[model samples]
Target: DAGVTQSPTHLIKTRGQQVTLRCSPISGHKSVSWYQQVLGQGPQFIFQYYEKEERGRGNFPDRFSARQFPNYSSELNVNALLLGDSALYLCASRATGTNEKLFFGSGTQLSVL
Candidate 1:
């Protein structure tokens, strides 16, 4: 009955470091998506995976990446971190349907200094 879960709640890093954020989707869900939310801005879609395959990617640079597991859980990886990369990383999951709404986790707050 869990909606979605994200791990490490928060992370702090220095420039040039790397960070991995994790997420587990709701039971029976097959689609997982990632988004980044910067202060004073809306969430920007980063990646979306369906059936363990890459479905969509956002305007982020190559430093951002993600993958979905066989169980529909997902991980978002950010390499060569920068201060600009600091934001709330959100994970969402939904069942297969065009009209389905995304169920989101609280998100991982990452800070780069």
Candidate 2:
């Protein structure tokens, strides 16, 4: 089964443009989460969705949003992007059980010029 998949692999946008990144979870997984990783820092949790319901959100501003589909695929959207928002947007997924290990995708590299 696949671990996780993210689309567009890379993106380039202006400071005020908006962008959307997509992800597909592994088979038998019901939980999907998003994270942002700056070049030299650990990934920061952005949002998490389980069973198509919002479960958690991080300290990111309102410009960030996400949604999970019935099939467990998800999308992360960012509005009014800023240069500071440039980073690797990662998608992670885990089985529906306690202590399940998370699996991550290669991520979408967003560059705000």
Candidate 3:
């Protein structure tokens, strides 16, 4: 399925804009991946899933893991979380294989406090 792209393109725009628009993607995919992006750095690989099965694992420690449900929704768990674990957690899903196209989530901020 084709995901929704931003309007006004954010590439070209007029002076004043008063239009309220919503942009999102259609869910449900075969593979999913999790990432962690620290401040002033790129995203670091965390976990990977393919049809509720783990296909690949990143260089992260055993403290990180993920579980995929029947509905394709996934949960990422960090055992004995530490202060360094506080960062932006992102998720990406792919319709085809794990290494194919990937649609990334906006990510959520995780705090140790």
Candidate 4:
């Protein structure tokens, strides 16, 4: 089966503009998730949804929001973009069960001007 996939691999936006990124999980995965990687930092947890319900969220500001569809795919929305928000927005997914490994997508690169 295909791995996770994200759309519009690259995008550019100015400060104060809003952006929406989309993701599709691997087949049969019941959870959709998020993480972000800054310049030199490791992936930081952001948000997650399982069984189509939000399961967790990171310390990001209210400008960030997301939702999981009934099919387990997800959409991430950012309001009032900021240069600091420019990073590789990663999508992740996991099968439900103990010891299941999380799978990550290549990520959508968002550049804020």
lDDT of 3 by residue, 1-113 (tens): 55522222222122232122112333657676877889999999887877789988889987677777776667776666667776777777777734576687666666564
Residue lDDT tens for model 1, 1-113 = 88899999999999999999999999999999999999999999999999999998999999998998898899999999999999999999988875779999999999999
- Estimate the Cα RMSD of every predicted model relative to the unseen true structure: 0.8, 0.8, 11.1, 0.9
**Maximum-lDDT candidate:** 2
| Residue-level lDDT tens digits of model 2 in 4-111 | 999989999999999999999998889999999999999999999999999999999999999999999999999999999999999999888759678999999999
Candidate 2 vs. true structure, TM-score:
0.97
Q: Which run of 10 residues does model 1 get worst, by summed lDDT?
A: 94-103
Residue-wise C-alpha lDDT for candidate 4, range 11-108, written one tens digit per residue: 99999999999999999998988998897998898998998888999999989999999888999999999999999999999888846578999999
**lDDT (0 to 1) per candidate:** 0.94, 0.95, 0.63, 0.92
Root-mean-square deviation of candidate 3: 11.1
- Any idea what lDDT model 3 has? 0.63
Per-candidate TM-score against the hidden true structure: 0.97, 0.97, 0.72, 0.96
Q: How high a TM-score does candidate 3 get?
A: 0.72
**Residue-pair clashes per candidate, as listed?**
0, 0, 0, 0
Any runs in candidate 3 off by more than 4 Å, and if so which?
Answer: 1-26, 97-99
Where does candidate 2 clash, by residue pair? Answer: none
